[model samples]
Target: MTEEDWIAHDPDPVTAAELAALDPGERAARFAKPLTFGTAGLRGPVRGGPDSMNLAIVVRATWAVSRVLTERGLGGSTVVVGRDARHGSVPFAIAAAEVFAAQGFSVITWDHPVPTPVVAFAVRHTGAAAGVQITASHNPRTDNGYKVYFDGGLQIISPTDREIEAAITTAPPADQIPRRPVHPADDTLIDAYVTRAAMVRRGDHGNPRVALTALHGVGGELAMRTLRTAGFGDVHTVASQFAPDPDFPTVAFPNPEEPGAADALLQLADEIGADIAIALDPDADRCAVGIPTPDGWRMLSGDETGWLLGDYILSTLDATDAATSVVANSVVSSTLLGKIAADYGARHVVTLTGFKWLARADAELTGFRLVYAYEEAIGHCVDPAAVRDKDGISAAVLACDLVAHSGAQGISITDALDRLALRHGVHTTAALSRRVADAVEAAAMMDRLRADPPAELAGFPVGATVDGDAVFLTGGDQQTTVRVVVRPSGTEPKVKCYTEVGLAVGADLAKIRERAAAVQQQLLATAQSW
Candidate 1:
């Protein structure tokens, strides 16, 4: 169909007006290519055309999803559909539910907005054949998405993703697809998930004063309830961000990892003298942490959170469980997790970036359970068996426990980090990222970096370089291991340069960390030029 035809049949008036406002060339440009799935699902700006997020695309995509599942003999099975409060999310989700219902499948969904984890959890809880969640997570305000989870409550991967993409490309047009209005199910499953999240932490360490923020998304209500249920009574939420607001007015970006994203939370934490602060992304799939320091308040790098949580969770593991369990992190994350896994006798696997890969660690390793998995981008799957994806609510509950336990010992989390450093070497990590106009620019940038990499970086000679979808540079300087990986983000329009400085722990732990930070900055600067 032509662009004009798409506009004529477009279901949403907003997108229809958007298409009518654009010039013929610009409007046609959007139709030059169809929407494609990245990582697990289709995410793009919500606008007119098949290349973006709209009711028509959502309908077609759901039709494709239905087709793929039916081919696997899952016809007439259940499909769980959900949405966040982003622009166009509600209608997109409704359109998807219509497709599933029209296809004669049992549809399970919620009347209200829910976090990304709930959809993932409910899929398993309901014994559904597939799940669909309309969320863009922490992307900019104008963006939206359609995410899919399969039978095992795991994000779709590899051949399955490709199959869905193929079906989406060849599926019927939106107007031709029939949809039925369906009633949403009760919240029993969501309630069950919150209760389960509360149980991820162990023994009752007294509830220390906690500060939290949902970054103006759907996680606020659920996160607060889960933490309180986990015995963390002294919780304070940033009131301005406690409610679900699609615009995310308080911060320049909704992501907790972005600079200044947690500014309001830090101020609140400092004012309340809170023991720890937690920031959950818009969809609550990723969790970022902050703690008090002698130098005032500061957010811990995702790596720091990973190390602390990894240590705490592993410490709770029994000998039998630890022996047969697996831990995995993205290759770009700090290598400290691998060493920690070794100390605990747990298998560690370094998968490609994205939680989609991290979620499949146990499946890849036969006869092993995946106890923990994390990515340095503020994502943690502490309860993989329950959620099968990064769950900010569970991570927040467990982080509170970590702080509470440390307080009971009459020490701060910083002291816990010092102990970790003393056992494992000091691992300092930093990133240098470059934004691009589109994937084409990102590809050109990667090619340029790979064609002429520096002979040395931050005083470490280039000992070896591994080239593929990403480039890995490894070398050493004065017993410190220098590691760097440059790759295009699977979910965004940018190329990320992840750098780490590994140095031996010394008598002056602070002094050792200072050296590592300086080296990491130098490495980041070097990577910036690439």
Candidate 2:
């Protein structure tokens, strides 16, 4: 079914009014499925009439959010609005503010561009009932999105998003959603965020040559300020994308993980002989690091970065005061961290992939301090005291600190990784993705796999299979038994298959890598067939 199919059969009367206000093509497009506030709020292509994240969609989403707060006796509740440097992000943010104001909800808007993590932090720090950020994260330039956070400063999840979506789905006409008389977003939130972030330190690292790139997004200023605050000097900003450009002119998706997104920085690093290169995506919540290794400027994987940050933070904090348990997403590389925590005498817990899962697992209640958290997708949530959401700013600072500390110890961050690998026996992982024509197709494929899982995958005997509504996992770690987990992308049109191979190489890292490469290819081919 097309986008029109989702909206063609709108069951709610409130949806009809939104349809009437749109032009013919727009009405058909939006009627597909009104963007509902999911656990992470609305995110999609920016052009689907009222249902999509156009000016109209932003207005309606804000109105719906404000309406929910008002109905819960917070009619004049305050909300914070922030936006990244994506196409139409600023306009969508402003539109969200206007709708909140029109609904008599107080709105505090950021004047300048900011990261989504900071917006989440602001919602918690300002004591606001909700927050809105306009960004599609790592998606391509053609897309934009809206994200909402709960009062505790994390993304709304489960029944909460469902409840808000229900209200939005059954609300009055789009034009009828309430608005206040004045702009409530004082625009001072930006300054507050800047000041707050500038307080984090990078230990004794001072006056180091660091190359920074924003990937044509809005992270440059924040990253520069952060480095300066951490006592780094002689920082070089890559010229092509030093400022905010909604079009993301320099990169295809503004995601640092995407191929070639960091090419400019890599070139700049080579020209300037910089020590390391740091890249932030459009929204800046995710960061990538490239170091000038003997092999030239090599970008580190999300797992490597996570290991460095987690180890550095745990080592820095006093063991006596630190929580006894550390939490990480299930898909993250935990080999190094597992070893680190074991040496530190801390328990390591793994939750389902995603920040939403980490935030809701109540690690704190369970005696887990949540000192640090990360996923394999370059997302990190550090400084639980500052923001329950993932903040690349803190993670970046931590990385700088790790580098500085390693330097102080007469070593390099890479050396530290080598040490961890030596200690942990070297674990390797890989993820493969297959794009489907539609979500229905993806779901149907998942259903079929659940119904008839193979006893063997790629000539390897299957240990067991996990069959869930959204995914299927068909293996366990054993001799000649491989592990593969298949799940549909929660926010995009792709089926992701994760494979892991654990080989105890006993300090023979090269052999481990070669075997892991062969296993990755075999698992990938098997996954593609599904």
Candidate 3:
């Protein structure tokens, strides 16, 4: 069927009886097709229709994954399972584990919810064949997800993602599948995670006045424990969101990067004069920071935070003479690490925008200690020695430590960013998205751009075009980018565009920013026409 036809079809295509049984919105939501697993895994609303993520879908995915693993001679292998505090996540984790155990795989399940990255860590540390995490990362509360990690606790990337998805698309009969009871193993991995996270702390402060929120998800208790263990004191918790609530009662979007998502924490920060406000996603894998700025409680952009943490990690490494290398996702703002690498005379590399790529690269490469790897999405991987995956808990501790170091030097994160921009060339990035009619349309649009791309944008000559399903980098160094990358929404009917603009390394920050802003307008216009 054509792209137009797919979008025009009724989402539910259900009978009158089923339609009558649900609210209008509910019916519509149910009708829409939930996404299947991708390279990054499955994510969508928990209560949506046949396609949405729910107990049934989770089980189906688990069964499918198990079947594929069994066929690959991995049936008896141990599988590590973890979950965040998203609504229905624990049950989903248990469901997945039960399915895996019933399929005859040994299961090591966490007793309490933990960050997504910890699941990846456990997989590698425990020598499990694969891992599964119940989380939607930074998605809205209505959403929950299932992310799979293969051997080495790395995200299942291309070719492999396709292989696993093909197996899922052709699932065996549900009746033939057996549902097993999930038994939780004695998981000491969480403690190991905490110990490594604590290593991110630098100075001793007895304890810092910290304000934390689970955001009505799973981060609050574990985060507080880690902070306290790291010698941070006076941890103030947000009253309403202190507990895990799948509904995410207090926030519109569960992600901390969105505007006003940190409003409550910022207000509390003002009242208590806390050192910093740390917010985790529903899954506690991605983190956001809200620190006091001269302009008010200004939340640092993910790029800004990544830059700060990268600088701190590099600086600490220099003092300790630790053998380390730096890595980042292709989409992140490179305001620090490149120069830092130049200073240390180490290697720096960029991968496609996912931990799957990062972790796999880490295992494949050698002589390069990966001190840190982060993307602008607030996903950070610290302690490459411990967990070769993004660990929000570690990131939070490192953020606290970075703040402490800055405090001792009488500087703020904003000032740190300014200094980095001054040292490296100022870099700015923006992402814009359009809700397409369906996947087919999105694909067709991308194909068209690939075939006959624009020659220029807003009078800036198109330097080049890098077209991948998940990445598109346009323009060259020294020339401000008029770039547009197109990627289908892993969980929704949207095509995301990542636009970036960078001036020469020595260009004036303010003037380059203005020019980049103007270029971005033209880039968006070009993209809309596509």
Candidate 4:
């Protein structure tokens, strides 16, 4: 629709006035392109335009989802809607719930802002046809999003995403779209989630001092309560980041994986003499862990945490079930999990880069059950049966459990990691991401890499180049192995390179890591020059 038409039909008077105040050029830019619906769902800055996330867009998306559900013979089915503490999240969620209600679907709306995983769990707990979460996860304060989950509480993928996009294109204007009063949200769902989260604890172990930070998101209270209820009573949360703040006052970026994001939590851990520190992303769907080393406090990379958690979970399973047991990680994640799985006589599957794939790994494989799944981006699915998504809260609980178990046996998490390195080798991973001016530039960079691939990276000879959604390069011989995968960010105008180097397990882990870090820097520079 034209800018004038959008202004005329916008349901929110405030947004309409904002658009009316804009100059012609600004208005044109706002409507220059429509927001594309992809596997991650709709995410962008919150503003008054077809390309931005606003009340009108939420209404249209909800209408499209209602149509798709009805077309799939799910008319009048239950649809659960939830939101986080970000700006405009509550209104957008209410608007979505109203749209579903107007379409003759039973809508369940949260009474207050909650974590994204709560909505995912509620979808299955209530047997809803689909679920919608109004959040941007760890995006900046100015951003918002709409995430959709299908019947099994899994995010929509493939043809489902495309079908919803088509429906959105044909949706009516905001003024013509109808809305109805939604039913009061059932608060019991949160209780049910707490109950299930508590069940993730396997046994009683030593009580290790812990520190946590929610990064100014909505997951703090729930996460802390769940941990205490699960028998980990000694826990302290970073005061500055405990409350839900849309502005994320303490950090420039709310993501735990970002530089300096977990600094506050680390300092807090040290001050309290805590055994470990845990940081959860804004929406609590991803987790980042930190430990105290002789050098000082250090945050563990996503791969390191993944391997630790993957191995810990694998060790708890029975040998008789190993044949049917499975552990999965993304293709870009470290391959150490696969080796760990193999050692236990279990299978490991490498999927595309996203929890959407990892969450459904069990269903895709016949006769095998997914015991654990993780991605390189601090996402872990510790209990897929309860919540079929990357749940930071549950993962945090499991990490605490591991810390307690290790402490009881006179070993710290650091000691356990060192032992794992001795058994599985030192697998160092790093990511190089560059923001481009536009999608054209990102695609051009990808094309350039594919057409003239690097002959060698660091000092290792580049052996093979494989192409898919991304381009991957493999190097080194049987003694040592290195891998580089380059691809464009699915949600942003950027190209990302993931590199991993493997060295034999031995006593010189620090030296091996230093060498690997130097090689990673060289590989990143080489990719950038290309």
What is candidate 2's lDDT per residue for 62-97, written digit by digit as tens?
Answer: 766876788778787778888887777866777788
Residue range with the least summed lDDT across 10 consecutive positions in model 2: 5-14
Candidate 3: global Cα-lDDT? 0.72
TM-score of decoy 4:
0.97
Query: What order do candidates take by TM-score, descending?
Result: 1, 4, 2, 3
- lDDT by residue (tens digit), candidate 3, 226-312: 887887777898898888777777888777776668889888988999888888876677788888878788677676787788777
Identify the superior model by lDDT, candidate 1 or candidate 4.
1
- Write model 1 residue lDDT over 42-126, tens digit each, in one string: 9998888888988888988999999999999999999999999999988888899989999999999889999999999998787
| Candidate with the greatest lDDT versus the true structure | 1
Q: Model 4: per-residue lDDT, tens digit, 1-530?
A: 66788899999898899999999898888888888875559998898989889999999999999999999999999999999989899889889999999999988887788888888899988899999999999887899999999957999897888999999889999978999978677678898898788778879986778899999999999998889889888999999999999999999989998889999999999999998899999899999999988889999889989998988888888998888988999988899998899899999999888888888887867899988999988999999888889999999999989888888888877788778777888778888788898778988988887888877888789865655669988888665788988888776667888889887755678887777677777877877776
Candidate 1 C-alpha error for residue 518, in Å: 1.2
Alpha-carbon lDDT of model 4: 0.88
The Cα local distance difference test for each model comes to 0.90, 0.72, 0.72, 0.88
Worst 10 residues of 3 by lDDT: 1-10
Which of the predicted structures, 1 or 4, would earn the higher TM-score when compared with the native?
1
Best by TM-score: 1
Clashing residue pairs in candidate 3 (N, C-alpha, C atoms within 3 angstroms): 11-31, 12-31, 30-49, 34-51, 87-246, 207-232, 207-233, 208-233
Error of 3 at 528 (Å): 6.6
